[model samples]
Every structure is written in structure tokens, then in C-alpha cells.
Target: MTVIVVLAMIFALLALRLFSVLGRRTGHEQQQIPAPADDRPAGARMPAGEQQDGRTPAQRAAESAVAVPAQAGLRALIAADRSFDVAQFLSGARAAYGMILEAFWKGDRETLKSLCDADVYAAFDAAITERESAGLTLDNKLVRIDTANIVDARVDDGVAHVAVHFEADLSAVTRDSSGAVVAGSLDDAVSTIETWTFSRDLRSRDPNWQLTETDEG
Candidate 1:
């Protein structure tokens, strides 16, 4: 009878030890594992006040504007053109700068016509014509464009005008009919800076902007 009691007591102690190590639910512990991360698309996960890109609407709007202090003119311009995006505009301007320069040198009038305003196209055409009349040819290549920045923006009478400052490296040579280099260096790269103004009519259906004016700096 004593051995049986001893064995019972030993079993009770062992059970108590196991329970202590394993722990028991006290009706206060977390009952379920956390739900797996939502596998829905990003846009479906959060709908209100958030953009598809995970930013709040206000945050996205702020990012779309130019990274400068609020100018009355620029703000007004944005108000007038609801679809205007400063980042996208600057990117397109950079590409246009290179394209225009190459087209001008190669006498590609059709390309220039599409990119420039009427007056600007006339000026480019006259220069190309004169070069051809003088029996001179220009060999120019855009080595690289270093920077393109928006220096000013404004809207006038439904016309939006923006000025972009461009700094680029180029290799160019103007040669006469005798093949003698008259200007620029073919072997050396030259750094050039120019500010070009682009304009678009808000009332027009065309989404394209045209180069209206240019200034060398």
C-alpha cells in the first residue's frame, strides 16, 4: 500500500512539471495565429486617401509639382493645366533638347518642324538654307546632356510657357566645300549652356509643346 502511494505521488509530481513547462491556457492567451499577409494587389489593399503607388493623394500631388517654393505664377499655371506634371515635362524637355540640336545640324527640317513653333522653325530653316547655299556642312554629335532644369514657368492668356536651362557636351565641326574645318573641333568636346522656352496652348487639343524661343548662356 505504501509503494502504491509513493508511485502515485511520483506520477503527480511529473505531471505538474510537464504542465509548468508546456503552459496551460488561462482563457487570456491569444487564441488564433495572425492572418497571413493580404495577398491582394497593392491597389486593392488600401483604397481610401491612398494612391495606387502607396502614397496618399496629397503626397502624390506634392511630388508631381516642381521642387520649388510656391510661386504664384507656377501655381496658377498648374491650376490652369490640370494635367501638367513637372517631372514628366522636364524629362521630355531633355529629350527634345538633344533631338532638336541633332536635327538642326543634320538639316532635318521635318523633325524640327514638329518640335518648334512656326517662327522657330522658320529661323532653323533659314540657317540650314544659308549653310547649304554657302556650300558648308555641319557635322555635330551630342556627346551627352549633363543637366536640364526648369528655370521659370508661367501662363499667359491660356498659353503656358516654361523655360528650361540645358547644359550639354557636344562634338561638332563645320567644314567648307574644301573639307577645311571652319569652326568647332571634331576631336574635342565642347560644353554649351542654353535656356529654351517651350509653349503650349491650354485651349488646344494637341498635347505636344513647341520650342518658342532660345537664349544662349
Candidate 2:
């Protein structure tokens, strides 16, 4: 019985020592997890679609254009129109895209006349007249333009022509006189890609570039 008691005491001491060496973990203990390294300044929140290299998609595209350099055609265009700026032209093209679409939908011929060349205006007018004769009206909304990039540029006989590629989302519907939907859907937003060419005479006094042609891209 004495031996048994001695053994029990030794075992108890060993158990107590083990517990002391490895303290009990309370539920309130803080977890130790390595934090991810952030190169951005403290309190900086990353912008949407921004990379760790600090370049956005648009920025990357612009950098690529610069690295590749302008083609011979674009160089000629720049030479013909000394005041032309590719960046500014693209910005204006984006605005013109939305404006032209909206004007066509509203059948605003006068507005279209101001923005488009004679051929484009005639085409737009004919479409509007046909729709009117058929007692149909178009309701269109430009949801958003995802991207607009210069796809082609050239100068021909002092005429500077630029083709801009655009990707956009639109909501459109055509209604008949009875108010029934004839085409497209108001609830459905369609994604479309188009290449629109704008031209201007470099020597002409008028500063506006007119829409010369449009094609599905």
C-alpha cells in the first residue's frame, strides 16, 4: 500500500509538471496567423481591376500602344493633322458614340446632321423615315461603353480617317403604333461591338470630324 501511494504521488507530480510546461489554452487566446504582405501604402485600398504592378487594363493597353509605336498609316495621319491627339480623339469618340446612338433612336435628324457626314446622315434619315412610315418608334438606352480603342488610322489625299472599335451594352426596344413591342426587349441588355470610322479634311477650316462609315466588329 505504501509503494502504491509513492507511485501515485510520483505520477501526480509528473502530470502537474507537464500541465505547467504546456499551459492550458483558454478560448480567449489570440490566434497567430501570418499577415499577407502589402506593398501599397498603409490605409490604401486597391482600385478595381488594379494589379500589384499598379497598372489597370486601360493603362496596360495605352502602354502597349506606346511600346509598339504608331504604324506608318497612323504616322501619316498625324503628319496630315498636326493638331490631332490620339488620346483626345479617343475620348471624343466615346462621347460621340453615345450621342450618335441616342440621336438615331430619337430620330433627331438635325442632331445627326451635325455629327455625321452626308452619307451617314442620309442613311440615318432614310431609316428614320422608314420607321416613321411604318408607324414604329425606337426606344434605346446606352447602358455603358466597356471600351473604346483606336483600331485603324490613315490619311488619304489630305483626309484623315480613324476607325474606333467600341464595346458597349445597350437596352433597346421598338414599338408599333398600337404600343406593342416590335423588336428588341426593354429588359434585355445586349452587348455589341462596332467599328466606326470618322474622317475630316486636314486643310478644311471646320474642326469637326464626321462619321464616315460604321460596321459590326
Candidate 3:
């Protein structure tokens, strides 16, 4: 019975020591473990220069608000074909009138060549050549030009036409028969209202719109 008690005590001591060693090993393992790194949050990241889907914000905006060249052409056709812009028509007439007046004053053949019709050019060239042959020179001193009215600006059978009334103050110089300069002075400035007609001359081949006639009063 004594030997049995001594064996039972030895078993209890062994169990207590084993339990203590297990507890110490578990504490040592926990202390040796490394800490977790602080990187970022959970979900995927959005890349730079890119929106939610794929395209950049600027690219998406440009795609939405862009004006295509074809659309611009269509808009121009609608504005021009639906109704003639009276202001634009008159602006063109004013330009043609200025071209003729300034071309005459400057004796610029190129400007006259571009604006005048063939018949009109023939008339003007004949007079100019005559003056040249006669040893005479001419100068037009223009003071002012007043545009009085735009009589008609219309589109007929795909042809756009506009007529305007213009008045100008002019001073002309005419030399006498002698080779020397004579009778060279500014004349009494007069205002004449001329009804000049013009046709639409868009930038294209066959762009020249011949002046049909003129009425001076």
C-alpha cells in the first residue's frame, strides 16, 4: 500500500511539470510573432488619369460636347439655304462696291480684274488705254461713301442676288493737251446714288458673278 501511494505521487508531479512547460512554450511563441504591416484598405485602387471605367474625364467631356466637321457643314447649309442673311448680303455688296471704288482710285488692275465682269472690264480698260495714249493721268480722291439702301436681297432658283444703293463723293483730275501738267485741281464733290447689283460669290470655281447693269441717279 505504501509503494502504491509513492507511485501515485510521482505521476502527479510529472503531470504538473508537463502542464507548466506547455504554458511557458505557448507564451514564448506569442511574444516571438511579428506584427501585421499597415498598407492600404481592402478593395481595388483606381489608377491615375483614369475615371471609374477607362477614359479620362477630359476625354469623356470632349466626346460629349464635341462639334463634328460634318455637323458644322450641315448647320452652315441650313443657315445659308433656309433664308438669306440680309445683313450678310449687304455686307457682300458693300465689299464689292468698295472694291470697285478703291480699285478705281488706286488704279489697281488686280482689284478691278477680280471684281469687274468681262464687259465692264472692257469698258474700263478702253477708257484707261485712251487716257494712257493721250498722255493724260487720272486720280480719284474719295471723301466718303454712304450706303443708302439694300433694294433687294433674294434667292431665285438656287441663285442668290442682292442690290444696293450707294453714294460717294469723288474728286477727279484731268490734264490738258500739253505734255506738262495742267488743270489739275479737285472738282466740286458730288454725291451720286448708284444702284449696284451683285450675286452671291462663294469661294469656288465659277465664283465670278458678272455685274448685269447699273443705275445712277
Candidate 4:
């Protein structure tokens, strides 16, 4: 009976040792396992706002040459090398025209310097000059510009072809050679659509598109 009791106590100790060994082995196995890497390719999706790309945010911004333009402006007007937006272009042009005309009326040289191309500047400046010489002033300003559509808008070899319908109401007064005041009257608020063609001059760093011609109807 004492031998049986001794054998049972030995079995209990062996079982406890086995359980301790298993627990230690489990911990060691866990330690041997490697941590997962976070790096991944662009195609591989990561969690939100996480960038797996090797490039730094600044590097990515610099490397990315294309911009998805949301506003109509000079950059959107002619700086684009890819597909151009006609609506954006026309809207920008009309906005530019309004500002430029306002500048001319106010004799703001800096505004004209920024917005108008050389020839466009020359024409506008000449008009202002002639009006000044004749003691005439712009009575009513460009209040509205209604653009129908760009019938043609295509880009080729760093050049874009755009023909747009422009309709606007502009009013100004002119004096006859006689020293008599012609009572100002609205001139029928004329309705004429013009299809203007523009071409880029490669020589200038501005790469500004200029009016090539106009088809008036």
C-alpha cells in the first residue's frame, strides 16, 4: 500500500512537469514567430490614409506632374499638356476679359500686364489710347457673356484648337468730329455669335494662346 501511494504521488508530479513544459514551449514558439511587415505595393490596398508607396509625400507631390484642376484660371487655361476643358477655358477667358476691361476702364496697367497677351494688350491698349485721345469714355461695361458651346476642342503636339460661341452686350460712347453731345442710347443690344480660333505661340515662355481669327455670324 505504501508503494502504491508513492507511485500515485510520482505520477502527479510528472503530470505537473508536463504541463509546465508545454506552457514554456508555447511561449518560446510565440517568440520565434516574426512580426508582420507593413510595406506594400501601390496596387495593394492599405487601411485608410495610409501610404504604402516608398515615396515620401513631398516626393510624390513633385513626381506627380498632372493636376485635376477644379477652378477655372490661367493654369487651367493654357498650362495643361493633356486634355483641355472648353467650358473651363471659356469661363476663364470671359472672367479674364471682364477683369481686363475693368482694368482698361480704370487705366490699371498692372492688371493688363498680367492678363492680356502682347497683341491682345496692344489692341486693348490702343483702344484705351484712342478713346483717351478722343475724350471718350466707356459708358456701360461687359455685364454678361453667354457661351453656347465649343464646337471644336482638340489638342495636338502641345497645341489646343478651340472654337467657341461668344455672345455679349458691351456699351460705349463715341463722339463725332463735331463738338456736339450725341444723346446716349442702347444700340439694339446686338446679337452676333463669333467662333474664335486661337493658336499658341511656342516662342514665348508664357505659351499663351492667341486669337488666330474669328468667324462672325
- Top of the candidates by TM-score: 2
lDDT per residue (tens digit) for residues 116-161 in model 1? 9999999999999999999999988999888776677788889988
Cα lDDT over the full model 2 = 0.71
Q: Which stretches of candidate 1 lie over 4 Å from their true place?
A: 1-70, 178-180
- Return whichever of 3 and 4 wins on TM-score: 3
How far in Å is the alpha carbon of 192 misplaced in model 3? Answer: 2.0
lDDT of 3 by residue, 1-217 (tens): 9999999678645543432221122221211111112333456464597555444564444223222432343233324443323333334455556556655654566656656667666666777777777777665566677654555444455554545567777676676456454645575675667877655443323534545446786
Give the CA lDDT, 0 to 100, for residue 84 in model 3: 28
What number of clashing residue pairs does each candidate have, in the order they appear?
Answer: 0, 0, 0, 0
Output the worst ten-in-a-row residue range by lDDT, candidate 3. 28-37
TM-score on alpha carbons, each prediction: 0.67, 0.68, 0.50, 0.45
lDDT string for model 4 (70-164, tens) is 11222333345322333334444555445555678756666565555567667767877887787665544564676534445444565555555
* Candidate 1 global TM-score: 0.67
Alpha-carbon runs more than 4 Å astray in model 3? 1-84, 176-184, 201-212
Sort all candidates by TM-score, best to worst. Answer: 2, 1, 3, 4
Candidate 2 lDDT by residue in tens digits, 1-217: 9999999678645543332222112334221111232544787775788666565566555534321333455556655655555545666677778778978998989768977999999999999999999999998899999888677777888888878789999998999999999899979999999989888877877677878999998
